[model samples]
Target: MKVLITGAAGFIGHALIKQLSATAEHVVGIDNINDYYDVELKHARLRDLEGIGNFTFIRADLVDAEVLNQIFATHRFDCVINLAAQAGVRYSLDNPKAYVQSNVVGFLNILEACRNFAVPKLLYASSSSVYGLSKDVPFSTRQSVDCPISLYAATKKANELMAHTYSHLYGIQTIGLRFFTVYGPWGRPDMAMFKFTKAILEGKPIDVYNHGQLSRDFTYIDDIISGVMRLLEKDGLEANSVFNIGHGSPVSLMDFIRAVESATGMTANCNYLPMQPGDVEQTWADTQGLFDAVGYTPSVKVAEGAARFVEWYRAYYKI
Candidate 1:
């Protein structure tokens, strides 16, 4: 199968390219390589795929409709895994237009291109943050996600809706994977795991959000890639479906910090603080839909995942 992956320089995107390129799939990846975090890290992710098989990298943005159409016209893709978007929940509070341009407008472009190109499968990235402020223990797709606290979450929910519209109108097979806090090696720097690891090693204080009371279903990156690959290969799923991809178990913020400490062999200087706006108290993903569909079971525990991430960080930075 020929697959086109947006945000190819991103955390999960890079991992997916690595995984799929190892198989029989021909992979094409594109990224705007924005300065949302560190562009160097994004470049580093691309550098990791230098000698991979049948993997082509294109530096581009999803917001550009003309370029997208040209690419689609040039290469007929069997499937498109749309991961390009203005990520970061808190960042959305400051620059909501980024979400609008990248998430909403950009996603529309993807849907249109897929429809025009007759692409069969369209899998996209959603977020557990869509279940904002809900008191639900484990966030499920069956539950209503009409309420989203941040613009980022709203855009993600909108992506799900947009994909559904495309599916209903054009008969495209669309699946939205609402990912929880995904953490592992080659993870995003803005995420908790990376930030905590960096700060701990630098002997700097880490901000314990919600006074260390918040919890998250920290799914490992390998588990995430596995679930995605399984879904990509399977058939018989509804034309438009959504699934939660995460570790079923939730870990407290403090516990996560301790795991990083154990991994780095250094104690963190903790600074407890109130929860920031657009932040949820806790998030737990009910991946039963994924498991029932593809036997997608998360294998890595938080402690082990944290340790692996720390090891990668040390090696990457020579710290």
Candidate 2:
């Protein structure tokens, strides 16, 4: 099947492309390659995909409707996975416009293109942050996520609403996967796992936000991709569906730090700090909706995932 995957240079996007390539599926990937984090890392991800199976990469921004329209017309994809967005909670606090431009405008362009082009299905990225300050232990797709604490979370919620409207009106099969804290090799540098690992390696102090009192449902990259592939294969189920793609287990911040320390064989210098704005205390996903649809279950633990990431970091940086 022909597929169009946005944010090709991103962590999840890159991993998804690699998985899709192995199946000999023709994938046309696009990314603006903005300097949200490390541009070199993004380039490296693209370099890795070069000449891999039937994968094709296009350096373009999703906000540009003309470019997106042209690509949609050219590719005529069976599935369009819109993973492109400005992804960060704290970053959205300082730079709110960036979130609107990328997450809001970019996603609207995708929905419009899909509606006009008659694409069969759309698999877009949502976040567990949409749950906001909910007192719920494990977040379910059925829960009301109207009270978003951050602009980032608000935009993700908007994406869900937009996708649902299109699905209802135009008969497009839209699946919004509310991803929990996804971490593994090729993970984002801003994420806690990557930041802690880097700080430990550099002998710098790792900032423990909320005084290390937080818990996260850290799902492995392999499990995320597996669930995505299953959903892609089984498209056109419900008109509009939302699923929580996460490991049901929520790991504590201190335990997660200990796991990192064990993986790198170096202790992190913990510097406790107050919780930053737009940050939540905990996040745990109830992935029963995903399991019912795709029989998805996470297999990787934080310890093993951290070790694998450390190995990759050491090799990639020649440490």
Candidate 3:
């Protein structure tokens, strides 16, 4: 089957594409390769995908509806997995415009193309930040995500609303996956896991935001890929569904740091500080709905995941 995987050079996107390649499916990948992190890292991901047959890479912004529709016209994609977006909650503070352009306008174009082309399942990335300082533990899809702390989160929440509109109007099946703190090899540099690992390995101090009190549902890349693959192939899912795709177990910031330290066998000098703006204190995913629907259960522990990431990071960075 031919599939259009947007953000195909990204962290989770790269992992998903590798899985797709194994099946010998025709996959058309798109990415703007913005300098949100290192462009080199994005290219490296594309290079890896290039080695596989039946994969096409297109570097373009999603806001270009003409280009987006053009791709839709050229390829009859069985499904379109939209993963591209302006990421990072804190970075949204400085570049709110980026969030609007990529997350809102770009998403509108995607919904429009899906409406016109009638792609089957549209799986887009959503964020836990939509909960917005909510004290509720294990955030569920049933609860309203009306408040968003960052512009990034607001755009993601907006995407869910937009998808619902199209799903209702055009009879398109769209699934929004509210991903937690996803991290592993080839992960974004802005994420805490990548930053901490890099800093600790270089004998530098890593920032402990909120005095190391923050907790996150740290999911491994492999577990996430498994969930996505199953979700993609599994038919007869409810239309206009939103699922929390994450490792249910949340890890404290300190505990996470300790795991990273263990992974690299290096003690980190932490620069403990107050939390930054647009930062959430904790995030836990209530994935029972997803589990019931698709038998989704994350099996990777944080320690093992961290160690695996360190191994990949060391080999990739030659450090």
Candidate 4:
């Protein structure tokens, strides 16, 4: 199958593209190369896929309809794995327009391309943040996610809705994967793991949000890639069906911080602060739908994953 994966420069995107290119029949990637994070990190990820034979890369923004249209016409991708979007919940509060531009308008272009080109399935990134302020312990796909705390979460929910509309009206197959806190080597600098690692290495203090009382379903990058590949193998079922791609384990912020500190052989000076307005106190995924559909299971334990990530972080950053 000819597959087109968006956000090829991102952490998850790089892993997904590499895994699929190595294992699957054919794969093509696209990214706008935005400077939301360090563009160098993005390019570095692309460099990793440099010599792989089955992988192809295209540099363009998803919001550019002309480029999207031309590429869709050129590739005629059988399946589209969209991981592109302007990320960061806190950043969304400062610039809500970026969220709408990338998550909503960008997604619309892709959906239209899928309909026009007759693409079969679209596996896109949704977020656990959409379950904002809900009292639910373990987030289920069937749970209500109407109260989004930030523009970022709101746009992610909008993407799911947009995909569903295309699916219902155009008979397109759409699957939205509600990703938990995804992390590992090749992760974005904006993520907690990456930031904490960098700060600890430089002997800087790290901000402890929710006063270290928060919990997150921290998923390893390998686990996330595995779930995505499995979902791609299966056909899309309904218009608005969302699946949680996670380990079904929620780790406390302090516990997670300790793991990071242990992996790097350094102690962190944390400054406790109130939970930000746009942030959720906890996030845990109910992976029943993913397992039922794709037999999804995560193998990496949080501690072990952190160690591996630290090792990679040290090597990659030359620390």
Task: Name the TM-score of candidate 1.
Answer: 0.99
- Candidate 2 per-residue lDDT over residues 106-149, each given as its tens digit: 99999999988999899999999999999887998998999999
Residue-by-residue lDDT tens digits, candidate 4, 1-319: 9999999999899998878886667788999998898999899999999998988899989889999999999988889999999999999988889888999999999999999999988889999989998887789988888889899999999998888889889988888989999999988899999999999999999999979989999999999989988877766455557899988999999999999999999999999998887988889999988899889999988899899989999999898
| Better structure of 1 and 3 per lDDT | 1
Q: Is candidate 2 or candidate 4 better by lDDT?
A: 2
Which 10 residues in a row give candidate 1 its minimum summed lDDT?
A: 18-27
TM-score of each: 0.99, 0.99, 0.98, 0.98
Where is the poorest 10-residue window by lDDT in model 3? 19-28
After best superposition, candidate 3 residue 316: deviation in angstroms?
0.8
Residues 281-315 of candidate 3: C-alpha lDDT, one tens digit per residue? 99999989889988988998989999999999999
lDDT (0 to 1) per candidate: 0.94, 0.94, 0.90, 0.90
